[model samples]
Target: MAATLNEIYNARSIALIGASQDPNKAGYQVLKLLLDEGYEGKVYPVHPKEPEILGRKCYPSILDIPDAVDVMVVAVSAKVVINVMKQAEQRGDVKGAVVLSAGFAETGVPELVEAEAELVRIAKRAGIRVFGPNCIGMAYPALKLNTGFAPGIKLIEGSAAYVSQSGAFGGALLMFAGDQPCPQGFAKFGHIGNMCDVSNLELIEAFNNDPSVSVTGAYMEAVKDGRELMRIAAASEKPNLILKVGRSSLGAAAAMSHTGSLAGSDKVYDGAFKQCGIVRMDTVEDMTDGMKAVASLPKPKGNRVCVLTEAGGMGIVSMDTIDKTDLVLASIAGDTLAKLEETLPSMAMICKPDGYIDMTAAVSPEQQAESLRLVLADPGVDAVLLMGLPPIFRDAKDTAERISPVAKEFDKPVAVCFMRGESMAEGRRHFEENGIMTFDTPERAVKALETLYRAAFRNGHPLEDLPPAPRHHLVEKAVAQGRNLLEPEAVSLLADNGIPTVDHAFATSSEEAQDAAERFGGPVVLKVVSPDVIHKSDAGGVKVNIRSRSEMADAYDAMMSEVASRVPGADIHGAMIVPLAEPGTEIIIGMVRDPQFGPTIMFGLGGIFVEVFKDVSFRVAPFNEEVALDMIKETKAFELLGGVRGETARDVGSLVDLLVKVSRMAATQPEISEIDLNPVRIYERGLAVLDARIILSCGN
Candidate 1:
């Protein structure tokens, strides 16, 4: 177990090693900030030469402190970092150490790697938690702690706790409150560089557990332990916003499997984050913007939003932005509309169904407030996006004051989008200061509202703790063969798991293939069984619609000869003789082993569309039917499954069942690294797996 964050963030007595009087040095800067930021704790500056620094008595070493040190902030040479830990171990009172030097593992030197490793080993033996050998350390405004070396970081006290892998970015976020238009502030901040000892997961767990932290934001390049992080995030109901970097095809080229090739590890991260109820942000600005909304407002009960704008054009823009998100314009109730009709000016054109109630510029601020309250009272309105507040009737601050109390009264999210102007700056601040989230644009307001709604949706529809999947003996037997499974074997694996598959049998000779075709009594398909051939058609190893026994016999011989000619020295394992599947919507379902996040399931349109359109959705494995249904619904091709062009809807419930079972199989069988069932025929009655490919792990 790692050291708890309480020891690192709430340390009572911090010792700054190599403390200096020179203002240019990092030691002087850190010590000065600690004092300047009003850290309400004892500070002991340790330096061998200096008797006193930063107007505080200096000690030569950790042993000379004459008191237990809760934290040791080291800003000395990397070569001496180990000695500092040794001193910390000798004193045995230092519970945590934050090293602010860069010449460790990041330098790619063997000696630095060994030195960093030694630092962790010593700290582990001493039961001392370590932050970094190359980091800016941490800061907590609520506790009045500023251990980082950055200057002029306005450490305002609020509820969002930020954790970052990049030390500079972490320090930058501490200054975001002063730079950005957001009103949210940090409760705690940490920069776990190198992560040689303590990890981002531990800090997130601590911050989520903190009563003062209402939102947790993380900037992570990679996760240390994917499973543990997933478990922790899944268990926590708090809103977590993460901005993950390194999402690119260049990084994805390292994958050796088809599933990995199709969707990179980034997609795996996406699925796992969603499974654990963590909101993923695309950029740093989005993460900070989202955190501000999450910290300030209540979680929305639903996605239905009521748009209230002073200008007609702004109301339309708000509706357009909301339409692009998961949020929907709420249907105004008749009674609410009648109430608005009676209360508003005669010119007020309120159309709840169309999504916005335009109060026009002629209305007073009081009228706008009253109109908003009336709309919020409707049961259909889960939240409201108010925009176009101007200083024509009343000052921006006065308007903000009148509308701010309405959010608390309704107990739902109320986001205001004041048109950007110098005059509206005070209005925005007043709205934010009074506990209402404010945005500069309508689209931003909708984005914030969407975040709040997603949080609420996840909280309401938490993932079910599914029972473990039963074993599939056929899969185990195939794995014992020490190679990827043949198509027939893959089909058998699915069959054993209660997944419906086309009638199929492996025939070693043309006579057997003929007999199998006769038994089918209709159109049959002959596919060469070669684990090496991912695409049989490309190698001339597949013959479909063989209606007669003689045709089956002839096609079998031709396929073998063509495959032998096309792919020389291939390990041909006979051929699969199966009945031809009926025409229906084709779908693909597969699971890929991500280096992180374990097995991630993917569903999308099958056949050429799978590659051409790339319409797909993903989710982590071991999910119940509800999640499976959602995974299917998220795809752009879902409308086809729902019966487009006046066609009958396919058995979506059955498909969901298949998805759930596949998830179970992937979760239960560790040796099975990948499962691809492409071109699955989805009909009005049921579904059939036309082709299957299961890749086994080398471990078996």
Candidate 2:
């Protein structure tokens, strides 16, 4: 049977090939690290020449090793790497392999790429789960193992598991981190280069299931399957923080619809991560900051944070930083604020601006603890961010000692920012020793609290509804007709899915338009319906405010003429004649099928606001009601929906229902590429979907 993840990654015994006496070589360096770190397992070295290296007996090959090997570490040239795998297969003692060789797919050479693929095939047949052919390696410090050849990289035993895409650069970065006094530590570390064998998703799945992993992180250049990533990250209970690079625009030249035009790949990733409870880190520094908070602190109850500072500048800086994050300053209770004012020093400014406190340098260690207890007990506070400078007279250690116990009394997380390195060194040391995280800068400290909040609040709130079955007929019809669904057909589909569109009638002539207008006994709107014309307004095919028969006739003639001149040789269908929707808030609900992540729903302000501001939010298909409401609240349109400018509140609950139904429709209909419902007039009681467009992918 194939080895499980624990057997493969947490192997008790290892066979290190290319064992060398030369310290400069990677093989020699790797052996020294393993032996020096006191790996709690048997070390079997394989070498053709050296009989004994670093006090470990060397065999010519793994096949010659007498003891059963739980895993094999191959550090050899690319040309001869397959030969080692052959030996691993023949040995039968090998359970897993970590090929440390380069010159595979990473080189972008055709021959090397094929060689890597062939390597996976061979390893799979032998039931050996291979890590990398052009990668650094793996490290599980709890097991006292550092299997990679990256020298000077310290793997501290922590709850976070880190995976990287680039081995050399990633490994060097980790090495740099290790060189520092307080390095960014991890429980498991490895790089999945080229990913011909094991991918980042596989590692994420492994981490998600592993009990030892408290939170997970990765450095990804690009993702091949964003849908699967959403699924895996959504399922993971622990926080999944990823530093996704390549935030530039997509490679596509143009899009068929507005939904596709605004669907930047990076935006899709951002929205998908938010929906799935993945913490998207911006830089390597951000990852380090997020890791410390996620690893050390307790999960915060909410995003509300109270900032307590010994310096005014630090408090100001912290509040400014909090303004940009998902975190909000906690509104200290009135009674609590009164207590803080009475107990603290005369210089202390209590709640001068909402959730802030300026204790000044005059405060002592005892007062600090008392203040911490008061805020921790307050119902408004969910977390605490304490910023302290060097005390004027008292020792810094005294402040740390007094505050640590009070901070630990409550389950809420606390992040300490102690500035002036050497001056506050004792205080910072005490905080670290007491299991409270410390940061040098106010920005980094704020980030730690923000990450903690997201972990506790944003992670894993996905809707459990199963995806509806795919509608094959719609795809087949679109393909057979060689065009996307018509506006009428799109409207019909929405109605079938229980979304109410406007009252309208199809009109080929001006008489039909007038008749449709008379049915409403008010002004009507004429929108050209054609599968060929995606943008009716851009093509001069839309006419509104037609009151009488004469106006309808004139508008019909002018619109047809303009459309003909603008788009020549286009097959034009009849226009949709409907009553002008009652005045209400306009919203744009759309769906864009991302290449990596399929069918994502978008919500934002309608008309010019969406076009100009691009203020929108997205959720993956078939999301829950909570996710749906979050998407609405994330955009500027949310304010307008909640009775803006003396207007009555629009039907937000009805809108949420509409969004859920649309998400289900998009999720079930796999052939659909885009769904745009622009100028969806949302009233106080109901909504009117004035225009609808659904694009189907014929590529299948």
| Winner by lDDT | 2
lDDT of 1 at 306: 88
TM-score of 1: 0.94
- Candidate 1 residue spans exceeding 4 A from truth: 1-3, 178-183, 249-258, 342-348, 389-394, 459-481
Q: Residue 220 CA error for candidate 1 (Å)?
A: 1.7
Instruction: Say which candidate scores most in TM-score.
Output: 1
Cα-based TM-score, every candidate: 0.94, 0.93
Tally clashes: model 1: 0
- lDDT assessment of candidate 2: 0.83
For every model shown, the clashing-pair count is 0, 0
| C-alpha local distance difference test of each model | 0.82, 0.83
